[model samples]
Target: MRFRGLLLGLFLLPAVVGAYLLAGSATEDGTPRCDGIIEEYGDAERSGPMKPGETCDLYDFADGRSQGTRSYDQQRKAQEAKASKDGLVGGVCLVYGLAGACAVIAGRRAAPAPPGSRRRPETAPRSRRGGQAPPIGSMSTRTGVPHTRSTS
Candidate 1:
């Protein structure tokens, strides 16, 4: 049974590792780079905490940068989720498969005896007087009861 369990574990080990590798491979990020710039307020008047008639170039560089960043983040999160799910699946298969295999092996090896098959030899019934049983067909030592053979 132990040998069988070992063999089963060895067989499942490769599958478990393969599952992990596949999950890792599935998490590759492919988002494009953010290079373009948006000029939302070109030479526009400055509004806050500045002298009157002040002008500034309020270029919105972050808008274009955030697009690629957001996409990359979303893809990264999706990849992580998929990797986690696959890892969980692989772990469950590894643990439960090995445990179930071991249990089945042990069950088969320790199967119960068939009906009417004697597992142990029958023994003489003990006396209630708390000593060795009296001989067959003899009276009890203390209670004076006659001993009889059991029908079981």
Candidate 2:
């Protein structure tokens, strides 16, 4: 039984170690897909082919500007509509955010703090000696001495 268990473990060790070694190095390559728009592939027009290191990005006139790879022939109209809608929605969100920020600034400047609401409180001073604040103990651990707090 012991030898059988040993043999099983030895067989599994390489697989386990290999899995660990591979787990740390796995990465995804994000390549923009060109599909649906063009069924048959053909050479790009006089615009020339994209450079070796270059990526494609379709232009969005409504969105103002964009940078990335884009396809014209195979590209669908829906993508354009979606991109425009996304930009409009993003603009609205930015306007709301700016309004909220302005409101916060105006409120801080115009509104007064509530009456008698203390903002800062005095803090206790630290002892110059770098040691634990002596415990308020009644009986000393080393000697049987009673500790007391002076009121006078």
Candidate topping TM-score: 1
Q: What is the lDDT of candidate 2?
A: 0.45
- In model 2, the clashing pairs are 37-74, 56-68, 56-69, 56-70, 57-68, 57-69, 57-70
**Model 1, residue 66: C-alpha shift (Å):** 22
Lowest lDDT 10-residue stretch of candidate 1: 47-56
Cand. 1 Cα-lDDT: 0.54
> Which candidate number has the best lDDT?
1
Candidate 1 — which residues are off by over 4 angstroms?
1-70, 112-152
lDDT of 1 by residue, 1-152 (tens): 46666766775675576566556646544432223322225643322222223222333465633333223344345556766677677766656655765766677678776678878976755565566656789886567788887989
Angstrom error at residue 80, model 1: 0.7
Per-residue lDDT over 1-152 for candidate 2, one digit per residue giving the tens place of the 0 to 100 score: 35434544554554444444333222212222332122223554223333333334544556756434455432333344544555555555545544554555565568666668866765644432387544466565456685555679
TM-score of 1: 0.34
**Model 2 alpha-carbon drift over 4 Å, by segment:** 1-74, 117-152
Error of 1 at 54 (Å): 36
